[model samples]
Target: MHRLFKNALGLRKCRAFAHDESGALIIFTLYILMAMIMIGGLAVDIMMAEERRARIQFTIDGATLSAADLQQTLEACDIMEGQFRSAGFANVHVNHTRNGAQYESCGVAEPDADIAVDVASVEGIGYRRVEAEASIRVPTLFMHWVGIDYMDLPVSGAAEERITDIEISLVVDVSGSMGNPSTSGETKIFELRKAAKEFFTAVVKNDPDDDSAITSVSIVPYYHTVHVGEDLLDQLNANGGTVSVQNPITNPPGLTSVQSEQQFSSCIEFTPNDFKSTAITPSQKLTRKAHFAYGSSSTRFPNYLQFECQEDRFDTRYAANSRPHIMVHRTEKSQLDAHIDTLTASGNTAIDVGMKWGVALLDPAIQPAVKTLADDTTIPVPSRVNDRPANYWVPSVSANPQDETLKVIVLMTDGVNTTQYGQTTENQYPYINFKNSPAPVWRFKNWSTHEGKRHDRWSVNRNMEWYDQYLIYVPGNSWSNRWYRPGDPNTSWDDQWYSTSEIPWDGIAQMDWVDLLDDFHVDYMAEFFWDEAERYYHSYYGWSTREDPMEDKLKASMITQTNWWQANTNLSEICAAARAKGILIYAIGFEVNTGEGPMRDCATEGDAYYFDVSGREISTAFAAIANHINQLRLVQ
Candidate 1:
């Protein structure tokens, strides 16, 4: 019985061992499954965190870009908040300071709320690099079931805002080609106008203070020629009539109506006092051959000339308040509006002409007179008066001369220089002719003929004695048997000949020869008459008589006729000339190949002065320039 009990105990122990082994196997399987679940959950939470971080980062990046482009603080904040909301951020807040620091806040669980946007500047470098960082809490998906509630996510982004003083010239191509339909189905001119207006608004926003600190954009509208507004044209009378008047006169020769029925129908009434006269002979009877009629003439007259003598008439007929010159140089909102309204886009693109006019307008030498306001004693003033006194503020001119003001010219051209016309002061000499003879002249000593020559045939040696003989020839003598004399030629003399070949020809070729003379003749009398007529015409009308250098020469030498050229040259020279002057030149060449020779010369070395941009990237270019100007620290 003891042996059987021991065996039973052993069997029981064996059963127990088997049960323990099976339980161990089950525990191992459960542990393995649990580990797998944990790992899979963690992975899902990581992915969610990554996606949230990516979304936040993208939003921040876009916000930064938008802020960099913002000219106003409110706009920057609005854009940043809008971008955050669009990116699915739960709650977004943005606060930015103009020309200062910016702070951003968002309700991100994992990210730290104390995120800072740090801006760093490198001395001598124009741009400031901005970096932002934030930590946000990302809600877990499956991991939340396993005691894990959220994931901590870190995100960061960087951007650069460059500050540069920009000197830009908006050179628009107002050529005939601009009138063609653009890719947008609108005329290029219309598109340009729209784009320009947008650009102008942007510029105004950037430099809103009117302190002239940020930028000054000079709009240069060029077609075949540049149109200098009538106001600017009035100041450049330096060369007299060398520069043709912008517009010219037009009038019919005869009166359209007669009051008296008794007046002879065939005879036109002559009223000297009532009639206007040309500078030439007054009231000359019009010959049938003379192209004169009473009706409107077809000859296109220049705009300047058209109203030259009619200014008084226009003033009388049109109310002075409604006239174009009512607000000549005032900064009142309506001034520019009225001026722009009067601008009619007609005529060819004269870029050079327009540029010249632009230069003249900006010339310090020709700056408009600044009004001196009488000081107000009633109001208290600051003890330490600012350099820019309130009374010294002018409507058209800048107040502070020391501020880093921007001067820009926008030059656009659809084609190259085709036709160039200008009034020059240089004189061109006319051609003259002269003739010469090959034979030499001689003179003889005085001697009287031997009294009718009765028998005085003393032929002593025909050759040797002839040298000793004394004979004189009269002025009208023929050279049959005449001797050579000292003063008067004993030999026959022919009339001195003058030819056209001897004359020197200089000056511009006339556009129409018929306008100067009817028929070409070598006749001296006709030539003399034409010369007098030309002199008189120039003296009265102010036409150019100088020869222009070849276009190639002008291009090669960089002697540009454009306002930018003159301004650049003036700036360079002025900088070199004055020790106190700190002149900055910024050049931006749009859509042009960077490797072009002209483009390369347009910019200076180092950071702020040079930028080459694609044609479409004007906004970025302007931003860079604005940032540069804002960063300038006034040196003591």
Candidate 2:
């Protein structure tokens, strides 16, 4: 009976153990711990995969960027594979697509399709874009339990390096105000030189890599006008022919000297029609800027030697130096920097003329002239720029679109447009007829030798020392009453008073209008004749009744060629035309005192292109522009 009771208690204990809820909690906890371990393993696997992907993405980004640079000498696939190997992915293989064409390789001689890479190109307005894409597989460490053995990591990169050829025109202002001090206490031109040199180096320098594309720059420095240079002048249709004029006080009496319109100047006169378009037609006749000084200080009596054009001058007091001429299609950094260093400031501001020349240089119309310049042995244009001043880009019509070029103009100024004086193309002046020949007026060699009395009176007396006197002849009238010495010393001076038709005028010498103006003041020339008329015809009573009409005629010949309003309008039009032709324009108003409207409108519409800077800020502006331009030549 005791053994049977022990067996029943054991059975009861087993049943109680099977139905116990307290132990069930411990079992559930065990299962939860197992799940947590498996989850943690999966998380570790995912983290490892992500790290690999991040590394791969970085490698691809760097690889593609280096490959896409136009300066890179290696093939895109080769560059990418080398980068991958450097990143410790030696066994990886890639299927490469270059500009929509595909090739498979493992960075080895054999083809392997495990990984993928692509490089493509897209055309931009003024640049060509290169895109690179790549993808790699990262082997999984723990997620393989879920039937996933690897995770795919895809990476992409794009770069553009001004693949198309580029041409830049740097238009700079050298106005008198630029000589004044800037906010930085230095002259505007001084600051400009520093900024411009830095900019030139930034654009022309190729750091650690060489580019396949061509990039050329032109420097157009202007004040009242532009000096297109002697070589380029030969290509243009400038009407600067030589004219023969008699020299004053020549012993031979009528000795003629050849006078060239370009003797003192080398500038062209642009008509309103020329400004209507950006085209510089070689066949069209361009008038030469007159070689005369109309400025108040220069027009002072006995000081007409100061010509309006500063081309022939070699003085630094006038400009930085005498080298104020355009330099076109150059690629050498040192050459451009040296050119920028020579810039000086003088003359009035003619922003319109500067802009016109700046745009013209970029236009294809100037290509013919550029070619001639390139062929020249002295100061030859760079061979790299042989095909430049290239045709205006018409993307649709381009035979090989990759051959397109970008045109750019950088216009900088310190002042607003001022009055630009020019000689009129009118024939209203009577002096025009005598410009190439001797006038009908003869001057005494020693008129001032006698006291003021003999100078005012006209007498012919051998006994009274008849020697230096002036004689005048009206077209329909006879010679004026004046004393003249015989050609022979033995002959009497009184014998010449015989008749008006038989006057002995060989003893005196006369000069052409051009020579006369160069030798004496216009007022003096006009007054001498008037005083002679009073002495010869006794017309002093009515002389005051008539004003000095000759002076009015002389002054009227020089009119305001380009006024403020016309200049502004022309500037706007050319800027618009340049934009329409797909040329990029950048304008900077450096310490501008007057309105900035013209300059602002001349630049490209975006704020990135136009800068209104003062003093040392000009350097910042130039740097910004250089960065903005050079930025396009790098990966996007």
Candidate 3:
């Protein structure tokens, strides 16, 4: 019975052992723990790879940015490589392609990973665009066991510095102050030339690889007034004056025939109303300013260089290339540079006039005149920029952004506005008897010892015998009966003569008032005529303002005077008008007083737009502005 019981127990035990699951549960736990470990490993590897990829992406972002900078002087790909080196990525390999060129790899033998960089740069007259793309192969750590080897981190960026379709009005002051030396011991004009030329080179870079240009610049050199060239006067249809003289000093003189005189001065007399707005109306009839100068006769007689109209100095009417006149939209660097070199400093400051012309060039109202000038050969305007001086940007209006223009004005001045002079509409001055038309002069010096006799008697008479000789006309009622006509008056010279016929002043060739004032100084002409009348006929004629003939003439000629205060008001108005139209203004006060406010108020509301520099700092200021325009910014 024990044996049988034992056998049953053993059988039961075997069955129990077969149903027990503790050891099997331990084995299953082992398998699950193994799988969990593998998964954990994978997660760790993926997270590490992601971190590495983020690092690579960060590096690439910096690299592409530096590479795409227009100011970056190094090769695009080279710049990218340097950026990587700077970022402590010396081991990472770089493969770069620029402008469709073949891919080139940096010498990184057996690098852990590779970064591919592609760059494309396009340069133009007023714009530069750079696009860069980068991708890094991040070798996976644990993921490779599962057939995943690497992850790609791609970063792309683009940068652009574009002032596309830009119109710039460079209103530079050529006032006499510009001739003074700056703190740097160089003439202000000399320094200005270098600075302005560099400014052009920076903004209007003519890339040798690209012939396209969308930038145009108009040069308006101003002094007391803006001198519109001869062509501009004709375009404006500004009319000149005519002078006529009747039989003068006669009993009830008769009116003589009138003759039209050419407009010698190219300056316009803008009324007080003209400064309230920025438009230079093409259809409006502009009165041509009379040519005259005001100063003492001693300092301004023969030279006549200080005339209100600078036509005598520049002679732009005769010389097409003469400067101090407006030079319309120019593109060529050579042409612009040459024009700047010709700038001469003379005349008082008239900041308002300068700003007026500067703003006018950018105004759309002046398009007709600009178009006409663009077709003209002397203007140096390129055909490609024929549609320049584009309309001001209005964001509310619907249009493509690329078509919008950026108008910039760089107004530079050294001094505040001074007294400006203009002429009257009426011919209130005396007619000048030119030297070409000689009048008869009779002189009778009586030596009391001898009988009453006339000496040194001379006049202008026609003589066929001796080319041309002076002859005195002695009328029948004179002390000596001498009928002198078409012959020399020397036949009656006996060192003794008497006063005879009154000088025939009616036969003299009368000069037009405009022509006379332009050719001769006001005080000089006044003195000449007054002295002639007093010395010859013992009489006086013409308008007298101060009882002094010279002073009267000077006052009559300079009828219009724009004081410094009025000019400042006009400048401020024009500047505000320009800014309201979204036109950018950059004003420079070179070697000017600190208290000056008009120039400061004219600039766009920022220090970057206004430069009150002196000496060589002017160049630094100009360079800053140029750089601001060419400053790089990420587009994407």
Candidate 4:
């Protein structure tokens, strides 16, 4: 009975203890402690992994950029490996889409795998794209506790950029004013030479083996005229057309007349409005003949001359293979540099014509003509983009953002607008063009004494003999007696110096003169009658402005001022159009008296595209342009 009672008591005590829950807190605390330790360990591992991934990403990013150079070779891979090793990474897998070793430069030839350079030609421009990928297996420390012995840290990077391949037309003003000395004691032309050479070096580096690199340039040096070498005109299909200038058959207005076909200054006359854009259609080619003025204006209508142009020298130059050949484009940088050596400063400024020609070469509508020329000649025209029309240009802006190509023009000038000259058949009487010695074309010195009075007696020489003698003196002895008639065809070569009765102009005379009265090629010549009336008015009256020249003789479209402001404004519009077409226009107004005008407006304002420089500043201007263009090119 006692044992049974004790057992029942023990059971009751056990039940009480179970119901009490006294040790429950301590047991739960111990279990919680164990759980906390496991959670803490996982958190520590995650933190360590994150920090390691961050470090790997930084290393990979640096590696990618370093290895992305198109100029680098396959040895860049070894460099990358070294970098990885230095960064505490081993057995790193470095891979690329092209091999830099095969091509000294990305475009030295075509690209190969193991190289990072490859940017598809956007529109017609070449670009460089690089992609670098790197991966490393990192041995895990803390995470390995969870059955994870290793971790993959992969990082990749890429760079895309627009790089080089430019077709530039450097339209420089080889105008007479460029020969003037600057404050720095250097001639504008001399400064330009130094600047231009540096500019060439800056923009087009020494990359001889890059066949795929299509960077090219056209040196369009202009004065009162741009001799569109017949090769160029013919190639560009600017030939085969006829311009009817004043008939050379007669000078001044003739009561009885004839209209004959004669080519004008290869500088076809285009209205100021014509230059609003670069889309010059086929119909707008050079087809008008340019006319020059007679010093004096008689109610009977003064005689005029055809502006001397390049048509006559076309056949000769093509055969001689001489330099300063009409270069509409040149593929190699060396070719451009060589051509630049042939520049000479002479004649008046013709920015309108120069800029127009520059724009024409970039026009897509003219591509067909260019292709025709290329096919016929040895020129390797840029025809990769458009095989038929030969599209090598890209629009400035379009619905498609990919349309991109660098078409540039660097136009430099040292003077403001001035009158252009032309020549006339004759005076019905002979007139002195100018002295053979170097002097202004508009040089019409009114000597104090015309009639010697045989001296003191102011008398006019009635002898028409001098006029007769002047007409007879041709440049070459071969063409001495054989003189060309103004409006008459080759059949009309006049050999009539013996008949001096027709000789007329009273009072003045010039000594060494090769009367280009009816000729176009100016290998040899005298002063011209261009802007004669304006100059006469200036000398007779006083210096004048474009606003209102004395009596409004109409030197150029009747708008006589120092500059052709209207034309210049038109040029501005053309520049804006070029810019809109994705063509970069850089302008240097070297020693411009007006301090502003067409050249200033031709380039973007305040963007280093327009430089109104002086003396040596020209070099800085050109270098800046080169650098700007270089920066604009495709690259990573």
Highest-lDDT candidate: 2
**The 10-residue segment with the lowest total lDDT in model 1:** 432-441
Off by over 4 Å in 1: 1-50, 61-132, 136-154, 157-334, 341-348, 352-409, 412-416, 422-425, 430-636
What is the overall TM-score of model 2 with all chains considered together? Answer: 0.68
Q: Write the per-residue lDDT of candidate 4 for residues 1-636, one digit (tens) a residue.
A: 999999999999999988897778999999898777767866776677677667665655555555444454444445555566687765354433343333233223323322222222111224444555544355665556668876666656554344545667788888777778886798777787777777777766535555444556667887765766555455432444332333232321111221222332344555566678686555444543332322322111112222334333344322221224346655655666667777766566778778877877776776656666556636544333222222444335344232434678888888776665443222221222221121111111244334233322212233221122223222222322222111111222321321222323243233222223233223112121222223322332233553553233322221122246655676777787777776778888887768465666678653457787787888888887877765533222
Residue-level lDDT of model 3, residues 499-561, one tens digit each, is 325323344232335544554466654553333222222233334343455546445645668
As for candidate 2, its clashing pairs are 320-344
TM-score of 3: 0.64
The reply for model 4, stretches above 4 Å from the true place, is 1-66, 75-127, 132-157, 160-165, 182-185, 201-211, 235-261, 282-285, 289-326, 377-405, 415-563, 591-601, 604-608, 612-617, 627-636
lDDT of each: 0.34, 0.66, 0.65, 0.51
For model 3, state the Cα shift of residue 408 in Å.
1.2
lDDT of 2 by residue, 298-343 (tens): 3233323444565545443334334467888888888888888878
Which candidate model has the greater TM-score, 1 or 4?
4
For this target, which candidate reaches the highest TM-score against the unseen true structure? 2
Q: What CA RMSD would you report for each candidate?
A: 22.4, 10.1, 12.4, 13.3
